[model samples]
Target: MTVGTIRPGGRTARVRAAVLEAAADALVEGGFDRLDLADVARRAGAGKTTVYRRWGTAAGLVADLLADMAEQSSPRTDLGSLLEDLRANARLVQRTLTDPRQGALFRAVIVAAAGDARAAEALHRFYAVRIAEWSSCVDDAVARGELPGGTDGAEVIRAVSAPLYYRLMISKEPIDEAAADRAAEAATAAARAGVFVRSAGAVE
Candidate 1:
């Protein structure tokens, strides 16, 4: 269903989405540290009592917002081959980086997460969910003997796009198709080189 068509679970979920949508708008306009729940309530046209009753604090609101983001995110698809799958994943990240709304929202949340434990945990969960979803492609490759049996699916997934995020945040660089291709190539080469493969009894 489209975002506009989505009906939240109940009153709380509805209130929460409203609050988060307001916060997201503010995030795009400014940054997370500047986000005030009271302002959000005002912008959302939600009652202060309801907002406080549901979220308790600004951190709780941010955590809920992050959770909503993770839930709304697109699911990863397995396209029969690792190269194609990684390309799809790269393109997904590239699209996000290029998106006016999403990129600004992510940067705001990430910057706030640097100092807020709640935001940090929420952001961590967001990445963890995304990684697990895409890592299935790597796992499939190993299962098909395209990669070594002991390959680390999670690391391969992370290796592909960590630099994309780095460039987005650190250098404020544009993540173009060329960047996405390079990311996919680097990750694929590492997989080919067995960089993610775990040797037997490698727990040491």
Candidate 2:
């Protein structure tokens, strides 16, 4: 398989993964302001038109890059218990952020997102995909009566990483096992306390 060929998704998804990986290299090597479409294309070994056609501007490219990230990442499958599932999610997030290459890639996106609408949109999609992946675990919890019927699985999943990201992006602290555990604890406690469940038994 090609460098970007063997990915965890479909054909289009594989191509996107290759592009994202190349874009990541460009971002890390050149920083936020120096990202060039040609460079990305060259790095990805993909045609420049393909890059521009698929993602539009640099911001758009960045956005799609994030979406690709969420896709390549393995979704959280049933792992017996909610807490265990959540722990798995936390660990995944922690590992990805801690990884030098992926971590820098995320930082690049965060910086690009500050002033770019396209990048911002892509970041949103990325989070949405990631959150949805783990939310199923919370849903399973409710179905199993491990959590209440009204529990908000999405919120529970988001909670697992909100603080973790906060520390990584803001305080620039480490996202170690302890931090992941803390995130899981706080979010789990809030989830158990009915923080995410809908009040009227309807989607909000």
TM-score of each model, paired residue for residue: 0.92, 0.85
Show where candidate 1 strays beyond 4 Å: 1-5, 8-10, 199-204
What local distance difference test score does each model get? 0.83, 0.78
What tens-digit string does per-residue lDDT give for candidate 1 at 1-204?
012123658976676667788878887887876777788899988998887888887677778788777777888878898988998899899888778888888888888799899889988998889888889899899888789878888899999898889988998777998899889889998998899988788772
Error of 1 at 121 (Å): 0.7
Candidate 2 off by > 4 Å? 1-18, 46-50, 201-203
Candidate 2 lDDT for residue 20: 75
* lDDT string, candidate 2, 36-145, tens digits: 88888888778899888887778877766676566577768678887778888888889888888778777888888887887888788888877887788898888887
Clash counts per candidate, in order, are: 0, 0
Prediction 1 global C-alpha lDDT: 0.83
Lowest-sum lDDT 10-residue window in model 2: 1-10
